[model samples]
Target: MDTRELEGFLAQHAPFDSLDAKMLRSVATAATVITFPRGEQILDAFTDPTNAVFIILSGRVDIWNDADRLREAADESLSAGELFGFSAMLTERSVGPRAVAATPVTIARVPAAAVAPVFASRPGARFLAETLLSTRHQALAAPAYSSVEELITTAPLTVEPTTPVSEVARLMTERDSRYAVVPGPDHTFGMVTDSILRRRVLVEGLPPATPAREIMQPATATAVVGESAQEAQITLLDHGSDFLVVTDRAGELRGVVAPRDFAVSPSTAGVALNEQLRRAGTAEELDTLARQAPKMLADVLGRGLPSGRVIAVYSSIVDTIVRRAIQLTFQRHPDLSTEAFTWLALGSNGRREAVLSSDVDSAVAFVDGTPPDEITRYRAVFAEVDEMLVGAGLMSDDHGASARRTLFARTNADWRAQATRWLAAPTDGNGAMMTSLLVDGRPVHGDTGLPEVARVFSDLRRHPGTMRLLLQESLSSRARLHSMRQVLSRRNDTFDVKTYALVPVVNIGRWAALSVGSAALPTTERLRVAAGSAMLPRSQASTLIEVFETLQRLRLRYQLLQIREGIRPSDVLVLDRLSAIDRTVIAQAVREVSSIQRRMANVSNYVPTADWSSTDGL
Candidate 1:
């Protein structure tokens, strides 16, 4: 290419586009055109350090972080007229990213020496300043503390239960504290805060002479010192409390910590958002707060919380919102509140692996003798609750997995009978699907001791045919790892991470749990229990557990990124967007899932061959 043409190309790209004609001519004169075939490493931070920045003349380049670390996805894919290799030159750091040709590539390399003075110019300096600021902001964004113990600023002030409210307030004022802990009978404790005093004493017109215990709110939200700060954030969100009590290993109170104490923290933001959720008296108000959930997930995950832990935190918030919705509906229909029923969270929410985009898969189980009239009202209340959830950005399950659906909402006796019918003929009328959903049903609200579902699962050992059918269903969703290379190369192709990776592991976990008579809800715990019972080898279980987490992390990161970009979040992930390392990891995960499914195809050894009468308990 001509020097004039190269200079024009440089003028079309950033930072360099701001360069003067003289500087551009100098860069073009000093440039060397190099051709790298597909799959060639153009620049490596660890080896072959280059002092020149490459301007892509043609083809595509994928800029990636260290491949060994699996630290993050590809930084970007650069096409014609785009630049790479500047970060290493700008920072003079060896720890820079690797750039590879995703296609056969042609590039013009401009020496760092020639570009140095160009970058020092006015417009170039402005671009450099912005880049530096972004780097600095990311560094400062890391959470300052990792554990709940580190967040406690001071020792908790304790007062006797008999102390007057005024006396407790005086003590708090003297100590410059905003809270006082009041110990109760049997090592239980309650908290009296500034808000409590204002709400209970000033607004309610309670006497100043009232006992501290009278105004104290139960300190049900407590965290251990060793617990992760993310866990504390979830606890605060779950309880919608202003503060959480941190305790030592001996179960003694250590200190009181409030979200306000930590400035510009994810924990603080989560608590504040959840407080709004709790105080929302109307569905619209709750919906507005609930919409911030994706942002919360991003913030929490950005702070380096594990993917599984972040999902758990998200699910807890969803539970709080669902419970609050139920509360609001019951408040509106007091007649329905009199019914004895348990609200069941099914599917992903039931397993506590809920994503923000997941539909509300739920049901309701009533006590045997609830009046028919009351049952009608209960159904209406739950339907309203479903509408409220939808209003709050949670979609209802499209497959009729809701309390409003007559098939799902039933009395305890009905549930037992339904389970029996499903077990009797697993292929009849979506029996397999119903079993998969209800097997993991966990009570999210109301009377939670509904044993119909668990009792049915416990008796799964007696029905070997049903167990085999369930195992077959679990193996049905297999991934074709052989075609992953072709799939990953297609720029516009997308795949559902949940269906391809996550569901297979979840299905296998569920089947394994039934195999061992374990009722573990979380996928990880189910795999652990299966391993413990020798139903699955410990190594395979451990690998599958890791694979499950990897898929979940990728799914969540993709959805959150989409949400940030103002795009509607979903389960599908673009193949070309994945880093080379991520693609490799996912391919390995697919292979493992496929391998396990193949191994379990021989159902005899997979299921215990014990005599049914001898192992009746299991």
Candidate 2:
């Protein structure tokens, strides 16, 4: 191949693509073209190190973790433009996996010494390190249970809207039930419970002649009988309701299922934990409950609950802990009014996608024109909240940039100014970072100033320049894949599921949502909106959503394992620990992310003329 052809090939791939012109030319010159016949053994870990990186030009190679058990063990394959053998060169240790040409292959043999200068550069170094060491694991399959009907113990007590409150109470008492479903017009049902009887009737001095409907609270949610218990649990949790009316296909109320029914025992840690969190009055008491979180997670997973539902439950618990912390903070500083500011959960927590491994990312947006003295007191309140949260085992943001910090905590006017500055210079690194955080902001406590925040983001979407900048930032991280060869060459045991798989999907979904001015916060919801609006093709969006969910499930499962082993949960996963099915799922998910990235590139076309040069480099 000519120098231009070689350079073009290098520029088309990663690490090399990040290199400057001079470095690219040097790499192209130093690379030697080589070919191997089909079935040729390329490298064996038992043999001496190759001392070179092999970048495929054509054909294929099969990599196996165990050469002797190649067919039975987890393996991967590599195609054109993929590099391998670098880990052996860098570590100077015998590689762990064996690679063989799966088809007649052509490759460029780049000596490690020749690429030394490029590796010395920061981008190249980080890329190579990530490629070599990062690994991930998958969750164990949960037991499959059939339906919510199995959890229902008794028939629902139904009553008419005009039934006397006295008669309804008498029937509930006779049935030993705390709740009764009052049928409403148009096939709806209202919930009348003991709590309502106490608070709305006796406490308010309501007459016994008051109708049942007058004291009933409308059911916010319901579940079909044949649905899985996990699905029912999710429905109940999503609506923040203690109980869900179970219905038949005809929509007739059959029974009720509460969150407690899913627990293995009456005092199952998962059920008891929530009660403990609600009653927790001190940081120490909350911390004690927090320690039970891992056990609760394990219990839920053991019951074969769906991963999405598991995350929802876990997030609910975390939310309770955080809100309780805020309540405690207020008790410590009675002068500070919660109505003066809004506490926002940012990042994964904000999106309601948090797992055991998640850290706290939060901010406070105060009401306009708060007194300076009160602002100072509010800062102290926020700081106390953060301290209590951290003490209860929630990891704080890396820079401690929560509501306690000036950067995150700001008045309504200050936030508007910040948003304007960010939109005006969207490509500025700091501005871009802040914009990403703002996109995921969710109000957890106090007055929700989210409408004002949403308006700012919507305005950014209205501007062409802002859309272009967002597209650029979202495309900043490409999905990383290791060919069979690359996987075999590495000594590291863990993979970074977040950086390689999860983050790319998140960024793509975020950009797509913002491009269409979507108000969706969760990644899956954003993709759904994008697809519905034709911002993303339905087929592609569906695939991307499925892939994102799969990655999340795997990450949650891995974190559960870490917690069981008495280690701090994190994103790094052990590939060898995964089942064959999981490995296959992960490989397919990686490819799906790459495909989405390419599709997104084709769709983003509104680049600013002045930034065209920078865009070309990316």
Candidate 3:
């Protein structure tokens, strides 16, 4: 385009529009037009730290941080008139993002010398400074400690339970330590620390020869060796202790971690909330914990943890709270045998995708044919547990679909019968809902009888018609994508992301897994399993997983904001509230979901062989 045309385009776009005619002409005159074909690398930060500012004059360019492995979807596509490559110029730092021509693109490259003159102008300087600051803020939000192993210290001081208190103190003194680990009667590690010696030994005038086990705190906190530092931190604080016993995958004790090791980080409110729930011997304590959950959620989100990992941590915390409530309920009703029944977390909890505002979707599955009196006692226990959960901020399902309802608290035989009925008449509304719920059911407590449930699910997989019906149902919802004209015309609107993005991805993943008789409940795992078994294309699976994680992060940020503002969280996200980068990511994710649906439509036609029982494929 000519200089006049370039000036007109610059006048219509952002910060350039704020420039006076003199400054605008300077920018337009200095702009050199460059063209890149589709699939061409435009710029790499590592090799090309171009000081020139890039404005997309036509077509599209995708900008992404190549170094950001945690943020797989941290990409933004800019079309005509959008500006990029300004941050490097303003901050005087190396360009951190790589750019590529997503489509055949023409870009205006204005020299750093010319752009420097614009920065002297007040409006232009303010805009550049704000953009630079925003970029820095986002970079800071990325995860600091990738894994908990980073925090694991060397082996902690160990002592036998038979060791005398005097001996334990001497060992601690020699080691220059404040704590020691002792073997518990329950075969778990117990903690002996200076506090116990000061409070019990000295204050109570106990003999120095008393067994260390008598005063050591029972082992209540532990984390897998591979868990994230954030998870370990939450666990330690949740148990109201500074220390945690780190264990390997085999449950063998590895080492101990303490808050001081990590510089004595401030106690997170979420951890305190978990602690309260665990120690909640009474209903009132649960109520208090529930009320504090929103703030705790706000705190965790504020810490800038990755959204997917944050959800996992929050889900685990919720699980612990729910499980504790069940334990407390069993204590109240001693007649109930915890082994006879299992508590099943359904919906988001079952999939481990739960967010701040997720509702309780759970049920109870008991062994077949318990005595009537014992059944009565089990019903009471379920009722109490449900009440506790509701009180702890997990509102029950509106349709009375929880363990508190008799419909869900069924025997193994009953669930099998229900599964059979649902498969037999898969198109029915109730059947579809039940099928969706049962597909995601995960045992959270007690004897789950999962093998029998898995057997029934495998049997359902034998019916090709059932798989066809589920695939159709899964694709019923279309992705929420606006036409180009519609997107350009709309201003400041919000939509329910759950309906448009999350549900469709979840349904498709579930369909893919069940078609191949894979029992992986989590959506990401389901996609991985489907890809591994060649049921779905690996490339498509990877794209779908990326889209799913992006949508999840967006939804979580929106919900956490709502929680922080004292409003109940929801899936609706205001487009105006998101950063320009985030808006582009969301749009890309939605398009990807649409692509996955089309692929699912093609895959739905294939029917597995009658003898295809491939549980081990994943």
Candidate 4:
């Protein structure tokens, strides 16, 4: 093989593609070409152990089920531009699927040592880590269940929206399934669960012949194939749903997983902890359950879960505790329930990214037409609710963002009016900060249908003034560094990770998401959607997402360590204390943020139009 041609081929594949010219040449020089005839096995579990990475250059390769060549695992085909044998070579283990050439195949065999330079590069290392370690990447030790794919026990029972309720129920019964997916024409879907049947049909005296669409409930929670099981568990815990409708990468129906699946695996104690939170009868009991969360966080982190997933698991459990506290409050004063309201988790909690030391940022959105007296009573109830949460170890927002503050709690109509005022007058100082926080608000409890404020923010995509304000805010928070190169600690060798690193990415992601009219709440999802819509370059978005994860993991690990040492957990980390590798990682992540901010400065001038057609010149 021509060395230059091999270099070109290697330059097109990821991890390898990120290699510099000199590194690429060295890798190309070290690579050797090997050919296999059709029906020949390349690597087998117990024979022909893989010693190098194999990139298919031509023709096809088939990877069979682990330890056996009897059948192929679902969708396990490798064509040109795909690679295999890397996992075996990286882990230095002769274990994995038997790879067989489906046709006359030419492969570029690159020894693991040849690609060591690629592994040292940021993008290359990230790709390797994600591909090899998976998302359970060593922030945690070993989770009981890693991905949602692990919990899938059966294929989804899909039905047309117009299918008769009786027929749907019969199909579910025949399959012994608890839910049936109702796919819509617009690539959306809903579910008709057994619980829906019992409550909406039987109890409501609806006819069995009613169209499934009439009784189908909107998807309460969903997960994509390959999503972490801990993430799926969080969805279940927060939504109080029986099952999560699983979808493939293309948003096609895949399968469903339930809480019962977690019950069986019992790897982490999250599900059990949530159950205790749910069953707690008093504030004291709830506080006790809440105190156990740190240990659970440590266990999750020990199991190799990433920081984002770890925070999500902890935050979801906290959501349950908050809801239970509200329930306990309601039990004491049932009259407060007479006024319909939605409890909104704002800021970090709303984004499901809170840490052990994070403050409670909350608000209350009452339904229109509630009496003035009842509104006052609702405020008092939330005050007690705040006290309970504080007793449970969460700190109240020192800025008075909690629902207990009258300024933060308002009727749906009032909230909408405030949002309009904020958007129209983007220069208002208080409104600008509030708008930033309010965009992250999500319903964690109560009616869960506060649409007024959402409607106001929905127009933000076309609101240039507000979009500029948000964009400016996103760029304002800079990573603490000396001359924009060396990471700098501010006080006593300590740096506020949340303030300097995490919050800037969060702000940038939120702005990017809103600019693209994306409704995604999580920062990662926001970055992803923004990239998909061309609002930001895909590679840049991926970099920011990686940086966010890196900093988040650092903060969570430091706080957990503090708690273990009997010190109060805080976002401020002592830079002098981090390991050499960790300190270097922080410096690299900080530089990445600096680079993104510089790039985003150009985007401040571009604006979305009424139709949301522009990509903000990103």
| Residue pair clashes in candidate 3 | none
Q: What is the lDDT of residue 42 in candidate 1?
A: 88
Which one wins by lDDT: 2 or 3? Answer: 2
State TM-scores per candidate: 0.63, 0.63, 0.59, 0.68
User: Could you say which candidate leads in TM-score?
Assistant: 4
Q: Write the per-residue lDDT of candidate 3 for residues 1-618, one digit (tens) a residue.
A: 999999999999777888879989988999999999998977765355568888999999887754444246536777998877665554344535677898999989998998766654535644543443232223311224445565554567899998999999999887666789986654488999988999888999899999988898877788887787777866665454757888778767778876443321222224434444666767776666666655445545666767776787677677777878888778877766788987888888888899876887887788899765666667767877888877777767657568767777788888888778788887764777678787788777776446345557665666767766777788998787553455788743776788788888898788777877778877998988877443467787888898899889878878878877878788777777889998888888888889878866654455353322243331
Preferred candidate (lDDT higher): 2 or 4: 4
Model 4 deviation from native, Cα RMSD in Å:
18.0
lDDT of 2 at 554: 88
lDDT against the true structure, per candidate, is 0.76, 0.74, 0.72, 0.75
Clashing residue pairs in candidate 4, if any?
140-301, 140-303, 140-304, 140-305, 141-302, 141-303, 141-304, 142-303
Query: What tens-digit string does per-residue lDDT give for candidate 2 at 67-160?
Result: 3465673477889988777655654545445678999998888887788666555456556434432221001111234477776767788888
Instruction: Please give, for residues 1-618, the per-residue lDDT of candidate 4 as tens digits.
Output: 699998898889887787779999998898889999998988774344466778899999987534433564523678997777754554344445567899999988888788655554546545653453222112111245567777675677888888889999999888767789898865578889988999978899889889999998888788887877777888777888877878888988788776655543323337766766787888998898788788778877775766677888888887888888889888999656733888888888888888888888898888888777878888888889988998998877666688877788888889999999988887775777888778888888876663467668877866776777777877898876442323333234666777778888998888877777666788988888887434467788899899988888888889889988999888877878999898888888888887878766754454343322254434
lDDT of 3 at 610: 39
Model 1 ranges with Cα > 4 A deviation: 1-145, 153-221, 239-245, 250-252, 256-269, 338-340, 420-431, 448-452, 462-465, 481-492, 603-607, 611-618
Model 2 score (lDDT): 0.74
lDDT of predicted model 3 = 0.72
Candidate 2 residue-wise lDDT at 243: 75
